[model samples]
Target: MHDHDREALAMFIDYQRAQNLAATTIANRRSILTTFARTTGTLVDCDPFTLRRYIGRDARITAGTRRTERGALTAFYTFLHDEGLRADNPALKLPVIRVPKGKPRPFTAEQIDTLLASGAYTRTRAMILLGYYQGFRVSSIAAVHGHDIDLVSQRIRTVVKGRKEVWFPLHPMIAELAATMPNDGYWFPARGGRAGHILPSSVTNLITRAKKRAEIAERKLTPHSLRHAFATDLLEEGVDIRVVQELLAHEHLSTTQIYTQVSEQRKDAGIRTLAARDIPTSSGRGAASIAA
Candidate 1:
């Protein structure tokens, strides 16, 4: 990054810190802005044309990546404009990148059972449960401390995406495990004292290894997939969507609603299967059956 970009990014980083964003979120914003500055000439001087052109340059970039880049750039330019660094926000006029509405891919029940039943170390199993049952982000799981677990109240506190501290009812197994963990430090403490806790990536690596041992096909199964399972499992059992939303700590109902589609899709699949075996789907019975 150029000197101008560095200074601007430093200031923006501080601003993000002031808003109490999670460290990962701040780092991502910095990375996105820095990459944009390095690829283009100057951060402060980029107009709408350059901004859009840069993002559109990569044919392999997924719609999700484009959306993330757009969000970061927009946030950066908006900060610059708000602080009087620029007369106008260049990002304001950048064309809206339409992101496809994709369904959440929750892990199947057998996948969950297989992973949980794997003879992994206790730590790995705990991390998996924290995701699959507790619905914590991997980052949140990484930051788990004995302080976050309260055996007295039967609740565990988690630092979520926005650095929001939320306490949820603790699982008995998690509470029992907490009793045996170090009370003075993080459960997943850094081995080398590089930081307070292990990086979230480390937690992910452990889970991946466990998944491999379970002989599950190495697809895009991730910690987030465990969280998806947590939500989907509840919804499948006819739990209220709003209650699941609260458990997932989703900020918007729309975000939680995607899991509903998962349930609907399963029902559709069953209908199609039945129609295939018993009734011809070509007779429109499948469609009518699904609609009704």
Candidate 2:
């Protein structure tokens, strides 16, 4: 990479760190910017065509990954333009890649029962229950500490993005289990005296093992699937979509609306209702029959 580009990349990384972006995000941006510098030699030379070659139809990465790379480059060039380092942002003109949206596959009730009964330890069971009942992201589940649970009030507190702390009513089963845990540290403490709760990856691993033990055939079942089950179950039961949105802590109602798609059981019930309705059969004497 040219000296000017290297210097610009370093300055941009420093700016990102100052903005308090997550380490993983900063690392990804750094890697993408470095590659752009190496490939194109300078920011002044970067244009829409150059970016297209890196992320467009000819790119080897998945569409989703390409989108991420495009986003990173867009941010970088925007920064350069705002700082007066570049005259224009070429990344802005890159065509947007539309990745197909896949419907969420939630765990069946029977599958959830089997998973719970598959010999998960106490802490793991509590984690699974929280995700299944509360619709918590795995990161939020892992961050839960003992103090976050209020056995007396049957509530649990969690922090979401932007450090927004919210309290949710705890399920009775989860509250009862929380009461049995150590009160001074993490509800799901890290193994071997680590200072914080178990990592999100640990929760994921626990679910994977439990799924295998239960012989679940759904290959897509993961910690997040439990969350999907939580949302879909509420929707299937005819709960208001807005209520589900709040329960799932979704920022937008549109996000929750996806769950409104009828489940198989609900679909069957709807079809049955239609079948129960009576209608006169069409016949050659239909008009005469009506007159009679």
Best candidate, lDDT-wise?
A: 1
Could you tell me the TM-score of candidate 2? 0.79
Candidate 2: tens digits of C-alpha lDDT, residues 1-292 = 8778778888888998898776557888888778776766656458888888777645567777888888999888898899999989888898888976647779888998988899988777878888998888887888888788887888889976555789988988777777787676777777886777787788889888888989987786788999999999988877888888888888988778777774777878877885455666776597888889
For model 1, the superposed segments whose C-alpha errors exceed 4 Å read 117-119, 264-292
Worst 10 residues of 1 by lDDT: 273-282
Model 1 per-residue lDDT at 88: 96
As a TM-score, model 1 comes out at 0.85
The local distance difference test score of each candidate is 0.86, 0.81
Candidate 2, superposed: residue stretches over 4 Å from native: 1-14, 20-47, 57-63, 85-87, 191-194, 275-292
Instruction: Return the clash pairs for model 1, or none.
Output: none
Over 48-109, each residue of candidate 1 has an lDDT whose tens digit, in order, gives 99998988987998989998999999999999999999999989887888988777777787
Question: Can you list the residue pairs that collide in candidate 2?
Answer: none
